[model samples]
Target: MASSYVEELLRQLAEERERADRERERANREREHADRAERKLAEEREHAEQKLAEEREHAEQMLAEERERANRAEAKQAPTTLEQYLRLIQQRLVTTLLVESNPVNSASGSVTAVNEKFYPLELCRWDDFEKQLERTFIEISSVFSSRSLFPSETDILGVQRELSPTSRKDEQDIRPFVRSAIEKPAERIVRAYYDLTNRPEKFCFQNNAYSLEYRDPETEIERRSPSKRRSPERKKSQPIPDRWGICEEEGGLRRVCVGEYKAAHKVPDEEIRQVLDTASKNLFLEVLWRKQSGTTNSEQDKAKELVAQILCQAFHYMIQSGLLFGYITSGRTLILLRVDEFAQQRQARESEAQYAPATQLATFALLALRAREMPRDWIVQAENCGIYQWPLVPNPALHQNISLQPQTYGGETSESSGENDDPNDSDYGASQRQSRSQPDQQSRSQNERRRSPRKRTERSVGEYCTQACLLGLVQKSPLDVSCPNFSMHKRSSARGKHPITKDDLCCLLRKQLDRSLDQSCECLDRKGFFGDVGVLFKVTLTEYGYTFVAKGVQKANERDLAHEMKVYSHLVPLQGKNIPVCLGSIALTRPYPLVSMAKVTKMLLMSWAGTSLCYNTWPEGVDIKKETDKTLQTLAQSGVRHDDIRQSNLVWNAERQRVMAIDLQQATITSVTKRQASPPVLHTRKHRKIARSSSHIKGIVI
Candidate 1:
């Protein structure tokens, strides 16, 4: 206020200035307070956010624990079937032997797994089993020599370990060495039987030869491993089998019998009806007996009786070993047992008219016994055969060593001998002398010339017509020379007695209306990677497409296929998730039977996993690294380690929004802990999707 009116104005001006200063100070304090409030709000927000994050983490952990508990409960509640039990036992054995010991459960787990496979241990009663058992014992004895019949050598020479006798009952866990030893001899005998029967192809044994043993009787029972001291007794002894056979397909030699050998013994019953009832036990039992001079009939009868008892014991072995078609013998009596219903029916038919037990038992001991009786036509031929007689004469054309033409049952000699020793010449000498006097020889020669057929200079259309007929083409012209229907004519002339070759069979197929009767059809297309493992083909099916990987007679490929099949089969529990579904396998033979085909190709049919996933094309919202880690974790849980986890081997399913692992042919089954060694992300490329931070930032800037 302009000097607040002079004097009063001077005081007013000072007050005004002081008021301005106070206002400025008040504004400053208010601004400071506002800044403090904003800082406090930001700090509170950060603390609240951190607390929320921790809660989220804690909740996630709880959910995971709950899921784990549920899974454990479900597993415990699930009904353990015979097949599942068998698979469990197999998995345990394979895991223990082939994988590391840390991740796997203790030895007690193996005992428990085996116990589950045969919980009841009761034999399924079959009327045919007895006859089949007896026959198998006889057949095995006949095939295996007296020297190879017994296992005394193996039992005495095998590895031995010391165990505490007092703790035997409490020892639920079986040492790898101990379990292997217990099963060795029985397996060797079984293998020998399969080898002799020429049926090793039908069975697959474990890759490792089992070395079972007994407790060292020499070791003191009271001696125990000293605490804090390494004992020499802790060393494991490995005893080699007297004879061990290895599976060329799989490189292991464990005691467990698998594949067709296992399949043959898995019988279907009320309790176990899931598996196919194809049990045709190939049981083998041999009883060694030395040759005795003039053995009495009574002694022979006793021997027969002993064989019968041995037959029962052999049957027990068959049940235990899980085999169906086998042989049983007691040095003298050999019987072949085919446990299928057809064999049983045949045996019944053969024995229906015969009433002697001695005769019945004797019949059971015959080798190469047909499942069906001999054809009636053949029986008639055998009954009506007659001997023919020929006159004997000396011949000039015969060698000096050769004597007069022997009296024969109409058997012929050499053409030169016949020409020189012509019977007609000797008989017709008088007639010839008379004809030569009358010039009738010239007339006869002219008549012979007229009767002789003219020779053909070239092949006619008739020969070509056969090929046309093979193609199922009808002859267009009736006047054309009609060749004999080779298929029909051969069948009629042979009367179903002669065996038809594969070529003949193919030719005969043309007569049928249906062109595709074979189980495996011709490959319509072949494409993809052909490597040491197999040749992969792209196949088009009626409903969907598939990858047809053909392993053509390559042992390594076969092994890989075997490994794949094993892995695939074991991962049945993981279908429709991380692994491509294996449709099945087709064994394509080269227009011949498996035994006769020189080269056969095995084609694995798997569901077409659309397109391979790469770093560049990882699906939207899908974390490739996280998903891969989860997949690897699942595989590890199954004791599998996918060694070949490459982009090419991973397929993307757009609909499922998942990645599937393909080409498990090169995969390995290993311990869970061991699996950790294999990286979850196998290969990294320089693709933009997974570029480094610097590159990404630069790219963004650009």
Candidate 2:
């Protein structure tokens, strides 16, 4: 029994040892599974952190790029020097003048004069204001004196001093038909005219418009009559109008201003309006009326007619070519007209009683140069470039330095393209050669044909390469020397399979000009590039003859070229007559090859015409002035405004006696007037919020 019990104990001990082993194995398996899950979770967390870091970096990069773009835009939109100055004056000077001065009531004949008491002048440094005015006048005078401001001294087209008594005159009878009722004579002046003609001699003095000669009706009739042919003896007796009116030289009437002469008493509002209307609008009529005096009429009627005639004649002289100013006066009262069209428009608007009060004292005094005839005080004031001060109310003669050249370019034929072995040939000499070249449309392919790119895309890379080379050429060229004309062919490399590179296109343009790597063309406007847009150069071309080249490889320049081309296309018909004729244009398919640059470039070829007005004199034909005025009127009718209408832009062709316009880059074309005017735009609340947000983003206060 002892042996059996021992055996049973051994078996039980064996079973207990096996159960302990199984439990150890199960715990090891659970621990291994848990360790694997923990490792996987840790790996996932690290991956998620890396992705978040990358996303944050990308967002920051995007924000930086957007900020840079905004900065660039702001730089471009910044105001130019002249524009900034104008804004400053508008904000400060204009506001100050308006505050300190009283409203000029035309009826009361009260005018605001910026004298010693002018608060703005007293508050600020007089020297600074004077300096600004000097600069302003210099610019204005340079522009004005440069071009043909009036008909040449030799122009003889004359309006009859007296119209036929029996003729029924109407608006159509006016030389330049009054555009609107706004340009009518004042009723007060017209009524006053029914009562008086003081002696024109009273108003006539040296350098005054009143000194203009009066054409006698009887004499004019007698001379013009078919039966009144004059022999040598009779011819000597018949009066001939002086070539330069009453003045001995070219500029007899240097400046023209208007004035209303009242009897120093307070005029009625109706009379004042009538006077202004007459002075502004109807004064020109007196030029047409043949009768200045009535011999059979009573003294009152005779006086009335004479006064009207003399005033009209004086006004006519003031509006003549080379007019420095326009003004209206009534005894001590004075009002000056603004120079530019925009300023003039505003002045006109304010003149009407219906508009705002005459608070524009600064505009008249500083801008229009209006003041009392305090000659002694004026002398004291005009010391340092003071004679060239604001309004520069010019006297009859400033200077006689005529800069107009006789030839466009010297002695070279268009066939030669103004190219010569002589290095002394100037830009003017080349342009003279251009005057004889073929008319517009000489290059049909250049103007009309479009070339397909070797590799098709939005734009071709080959063209871009070509433009880059051209710009490089312009930068290195001179404007005063003549360039050789050479032929350029699209020749391939020895391999005959290589694509055209930037170097190749440049070489092609160089060859066309016969210009080697060391040689360059001449710049016309100036010797170097003034800005990023482009440089103006005198180029002799084999295909287009002598041409003025404007090349712009920068994006801004490209935009300017595009705008000019658009304007050129519109005025193509008037080319060589009143505008620069666009000969052709060139563009590279891609942006110029410059560092950090990815924009297209373009070049324009225009007919080499006359120099700017500064270098030329006014044509001596009244017809030309009339034509120019007509052109302005036509432009206005078309809803187009020549915003940059100034002397520099007016190019005068002495040979053809033509006045052509250049630089229409700042022109604007307005939308046509609606037959049924559209209701004013009203923004919804959501739109207003969006607008406010956009303005804020643009750094503009709405």
Candidate 3:
């Protein structure tokens, strides 16, 4: 039975071996197939690369050949001045074989040339050649002398002459003709060349070779019209009087006859001068009086017409003086005007009148008021008046007291007062004094009556208050004294009556209280006499609780007081480097607050310091130890040379002890200092002695 069992086990093993063989064979076959496929793809890629390279070479060769052919074609063509050269070459090449076959008809046959070589044709017509030459000439001329070929000045003058009046048009046209004549030499050379070489040709066909013969008469017909004939002149029409008038002809066309329309005789100089003087005076009065005194629209219209007439007279005067630049007559009015430059001078005169001086205006008003006796030179007299003064007084008493200067009008005689004058001015002075003093007396009486009752009540109240306190034998507090238990009392005692809740106060205290103060104090007891160090105390009341901070020093100074306030003011509700815990009367000052240092550090590092903290102490999901390790690693990598790495400055938070790099004025970011160096290595060795060998040797010797 054991043998059979062993045999069965051996058979099972063989079957397993056969299965392993089949699996190995299948894997090997897949790998070989993959290899063959990769080899075939590589070969196909190589073949494609070779084929593309061959095509690129072939394309380059074809492009080179095409460029060479273009170059040869361009070399055969030459620039020519004659218009018929291009057409002649094309016609000769196209009809050359046919022309050469009919040699007997050469004299009368149509001829053309290409490259200065003749072509003779028996069936070709001279009219056809002439037409082709004409068309070629026109095309060549257009190509050579395009629209831009004409001089700009000549073109502009031609257009202007077309639009000018008939009398001026002839003169404008003559300018361009004169310019064209000056440039005739160059034009003649071009014309001669065009006529000689651009004409139709005759040819001779001798010994089977094409040759040129005498030229044939061109068959082109001139299509331009002949010049018109001029008619003889008729007798001159009779002249009308030299006066300006507008005439309407039969077709309703209006014609201006200036000669017939001229005034029969010039208006008399004296009459014209009188009209001008009247217009000027009216215009001056209208402008000046309208400005001073308001007038109706009808009056203003009359004033404007008079001004227009004055302007017309001035314009005519300018024309008569030969200073008029131009004239334009519209109907009855002949506006003899000057250029804008000369008109500005006239405008200056009108503007001076329009904007008369203040003294001139005042003088005009005075003259108008005293029109009966006012002289024409009153304006000049007023201008010469050195100073004019007007006095204003509250009463006639004061007015009479002030002296008046005597007036001198052109050194004229003075008139004495008449019998109407009074011996005493007492009636007038008394009336003026009564009028001025009445209101003041009434106001004073009213004020006295209004105040009497309030004064009596105030005096009674004062007597009653003094009597009441004296009767009770108890003193009343002064008004300036404040009541007890007031919130203002604490504020006044600590930081003055001003509110201490302001942001500037908080900021100032926080910035100033970052340092300590030293103070000295002497103490005496029954047991012994001793000197005590006066410690500086900085206290701050925050949202959480009151904190009493003590700085251990020898004495207190101004800097200590400032530092205390600075640190105390910046303390958060429940945060800071050192927070005081209130234990009954005595407060226990902890090294740091139980607040998130990382959050406080972040708040302090922010661009604005007034924002709230973004972290909390004992924060969930925070690993303080891991974060501390990371911070240390980062600090090491950043080469931050930290000196004050104590628990106070390095606050412990839930996630991390935010390292507040304090006292940076003394610390620098540099290589590690001696205090931060690594510990030295120490080595110890274990000893194994050979004392047994010496003892055995001694026993053997015995």
TM-score of each: 0.22, 0.22, 0.14
Model 3 per-residue lDDT tens digits across residues 255-335: 111111111011112222222222321232233234334452463234333333333333222211112121211111222
Among these predictions, the greatest TM-score belongs to: 2
Whole-model Cα lDDT of every candidate shown, in order? 0.32, 0.31, 0.24
In model 2, where do residues sit more than 4 Å from their true spots? 1-520, 525-534, 542-546, 551-553, 588-601, 621-627, 634-639, 671-702
lDDT of 3 at 690: 13
Among all windows of 10 consecutive residues in model 3, the one with the lowest summed lDDT is: 594-603
Cα deviation at 329, candidate 1, in Å, is 65
Candidate 2 lDDT over residue span 1-702, tens digit each: 999999998898888888778877888888888887888888888888888889999999999999998876664454323223223322322222111112252133222211111010000001122233334434433433333222211121121113222221221222121100111112111111222322111111122221212233344455557997656554322111111111111111111123223222332222332222222222212211213222324432333233333232222222222121233332122333321111111111211111111111112222222111111111122222212211122232422221211111122222333222111100110000001121221112321212311111111111011211222232222221121211121132223222233234333444553321111333221122222234443444322222234343344444556666665555544544455445445554332221111122445555444545553466554465565566666656655567766555555654346666656656765634333222111100000101111111211000
Residues 347-414 of candidate 1 have per-residue lDDT tens digits of 22222112122122223322112112111121122212210011111132422332221221112222
lDDT of 2 at 437: 21
- The local distance difference test score of model 1 is 0.32
* Full candidate order by lDDT, most accurate first: 1, 2, 3
Going through the candidates in the order shown, the clash numbers are 36, 48, 22
